[model samples]
Target: MRAVMNAILNVVLPVFGIMLAGYLVGRARILGEDSGRALNGFVYYVALPALFFGSMADVPLARIFNWPLILSFGGGLLVTFLFSIAVALVFFRGRFGEVSMHGLTAIFSNTGYMGVPLLQIAFGQQGVLAAVITTVITAVVVIGIGVILLETDRHQGSAPRVIARNVSLGLAKNPLILSALAGILYSWSGLPLPQPVATFMELTGNAAAPAALFAIGLFMVGKSLTEGMREVVWISSLKLLVAPLVTAWLAYSVLGMQGVDAKAAIIQAALPTGALMFVLAQQYGVYVQRATSVILVSTVLSVLTLSALFVLLGVQ
Candidate 1:
């Protein structure tokens, strides 16, 4: 019992401590909104990409694929993606674009920011491999589908070719996706990350977590979490509860994943919704308020749920 509490303290405190610092910083208004954007740009375009690239560089090609783990994580993510769409359609009476937006918010975990740091804190650098893979998958699968739905609507009545072109363009422009691809290609080619290049990436990648957590804090400040209670509760519940359970079951039963690998899949599945989903919502101008509300609620609840989960899995 003492050990469990210790594990929680060791794992949870530092992670949330950084977040608290970010929140306090935001509350103090030491920096303006533009500073927050610059921090986010560093995280998304620079730090996260370097992290993913280094994670994959020179690792065995087979290890990177890690089929059982991938199956468990990807299957769980896909199920939640579909589940959110159904809920939006039936309960919310949402339109096509709104449904797509809902699906994005529900399925896309905060893998790049929270997942990387949380897993590293819990399981050390070895754990980051799964986090990186999960982030890459989210980029390709979630964002790809989002672009399809969003572009399809904008180009309503146009040929499929136009939509495809737009999707390709968007994917090309995303540093996260391109970095993952580069990492995989480098691994496949059996090339080593050169010493100087590796050092540069490591230095930059180390900044990803703190910057991301702090920026999340900055973004949370001045936002009204008051209005979207009903939708927020519903979405957060599914993201925190249902998604992790499904991933664990699939990992054990369907994928035959056990031990540390199974735990990794489940943890990654249970992360709070990514703020990138909020970016998508803002882009489409649909369900922005509810999306914002869902992220905060999910993040707060995940502390309890994730702590219990680690104990159950004996990961702590």
Candidate 2:
């Protein structure tokens, strides 16, 4: 019991404290409303990429390509995603765009911002490696499917080939994905990073955790649980509860993932819905209120859920 309490205090509080500071700052209007956007841009375009690249650059190809971790995490996400779609269709009578967004909200764990930082704090660089792998999976597979579905819904008569091409191009241009791949390639070459470059990456990457968490709090400032309370509860359950359970089962029982790989996969699965889903909701003007509610509610509730999970996973 004492160990559990310590884990909560030592790991969870600090992460959420930074986020709360950001939220308070935003609420006070100390900075412009766009402050979150700017911070997120820095994290996304600069800090996160550097972190991913730097982490992956030194890892061996064998460790980096852990198939069990990949399959377990990816399978869990796919299952949750498909289940969310079914719920959307049957319960909400949602169309393609709305269902796609719903699925995204359920499966899109905030791996980039919250997951990376939390894992780094709890388990260090090994945890971060697991996070980077999951981030890539979410960015590439989950986001790709969501975008394709939304685009197809929006452009009913457009050519399938064009939509596929556009989505491919967008994913190709994603900085996180590009950086991870680049790091893998560099690692494959088996060349050490020069002192200057390594120093630069370390300095820049160090900023990613705090900046990303603060950005989440800032982004969350104005959102509230205004409408779609039932749907909000449903999707939040999937994201915060069911997803993690499924991932845990797969990682431990089915896929034989042990140690940090299993723990990180489960933790990442339990993360609150990513803010990117809200961005996509706003952009497509589909399920906007529900998306906002899911993000906000899930984030607040995750404080308890994640704390319990840390205890269960024996994270210290």
Candidate 3:
């Protein structure tokens, strides 16, 4: 009991507290309207890439290639994604681009921003590695699929070669994927980073967690829950509940994963819908309102869900 309490207090409270602070700051207009955008840009372009690179650079290539972890988490994510797509099609009668966005909102966990910080607090470096792996899975496999579907839908009359080229270029431009790949290559090389370079990465990467969380809070400032109540509830339920359950079943029953690896996978799975979902929706002009609602509702609900999960997993 004491351990559970400690885990919630130590791990969960601080993470949410920072987010709350960001929310307050944004609400009050303390940092001006552009603060959130600037912070998010910094985290995405600089901090997160540095963090991914640094985290992967020193780890052994063998340890990084945890197939069971990949299979369990990726499998669960795909299942949730497909289920969401079915719901969107059968119930909402959504178009192809809209259905794709619905699936994305269901499966895209905020692993880069929330998971990394939360797992690092609870499980340390091992936790970070788990986060990196899942982030890669989400970024490369899930987002890649969503982008391709959206592009195909938008450019139905265009040649396949054009759509493929566009998707390829977009994925290649993602700094997170590029940095993770670079780190893996560095790990494969088995060369140590010089002191200056290592120090720079550490300094930059350490800023990712707090800045990312704060940016989330700031981003939520003007979003309202007044629109799309039914869809919001449905999407939020899939993200906050169904995704984690599927992941837990796969990690424990199917894959036989145990310890921090399994726990991290489940926790990342349970995270709120990624903010990137909203960005994608805005970019494609599909499922925009529901995306906002899911991100907002899931994030608020995740406080209780994640705390309960920490206690259940004996995180302390």
Candidate 4:
């Protein structure tokens, strides 16, 4: 119980507190709307890449190659996607497009922004690296395969071109994928970073999480909580509950995984559906409100869900 309390206080509370501060700042108009956009852009373009590159550059490639951990995570996503689709089809029979959008939103996760940091706090650096790889998988699949799944129009384009463009574009700009590539190149080259450059990246990278959480908090303040609640409940359940359970079973039973690897996979599975869903909705003019609602609510609830997961995994 004491250990559990410590995890909540040391790991979870600090994260949420920073997020709350960001939320308050946004609400009070200190940072204002443009500031919020700038903040997100800074984190996305600058800080996240630094963090990813820094973490990966030093870690051994072998540590990031835990097949059980990778398979467990990837498998959980596949299962969750299938389950979400089934539920959508059964419950939302007519609204295939909207239901599919909600389903996709329910299963994917912001493994980069939230999952990696929280896992690092609870587990360690190795967990962070593993989670980073998970983020890579998330970006590639969710951006490409997910988009393909949600696309209902046959006249949208040639399927091959659509997929190729998505995959190409996703690989180009995503910090996680680029970082992975950079880290791998650095590792293969066997070159160490210059002291000044290393220190600079480290300093900037550390700022990413707090800023991100704050942005999330502020974004939450402006949302229509009441209107979004119904979708939130449904989407959050699929993300926080169903996804993790499936991941746990796969990790423990199917893969015989134990220790930190298993824990990381489970927690990643439970992460709030990625905010990318909302972005994609806006890009494609899909169910934008429902996607945003799921992202918001799932993130709020993940504080509780993740804390409990930490306790379950004996994080101390």
RMSD of each: 3.5, 3.9, 3.7, 4.4
Deviation in Å, model 3, residue 283 alpha carbon: 6.5
Model 3 clash pairs? Answer: none
**Clashing residue pairs found in predicted model 2:** none
Residue 271 Cα positional deviation in candidate 1, in Å, after optimal superposition: 2.9
Clashes of each: 0, 0, 0, 1
Local accuracy of candidate 1 as per-residue lDDT tens digits, 127-184: 8888777876776567667866766565656578876787677667767668877887
| Local distance difference test, candidate 4 | 0.72
- Sorted on TM-score, best first, the list reads 1, 3, 2, 4
For candidate 1, what is the lDDT? 0.74
lDDT of each model, Cα atoms only?
Answer: 0.74, 0.79, 0.79, 0.72
With candidate 1 superimposed using the best TM-score fit, by how many Å does residue 142's alpha carbon deviate from the native? 3.9
Q: How far is candidate 3 from the true structure (C-alpha RMSD, Å)?
A: 3.7
1-316, model 2: which lDDT tens digit per residue? 5644454345456666887898899899999977877776787779867876887786677765778889888989989988988878889877678888888899888787678777887888998889888877786567657766776677656588877776576657767668877887998999999889888888997787778667767766777656678888999999999999999999988987779999999999998887667556654568766876787788778878988899899887
TM-score of structure candidate 4: 0.73
What are the TM-scores, per candidate, against the unseen true structure? 0.80, 0.76, 0.78, 0.73
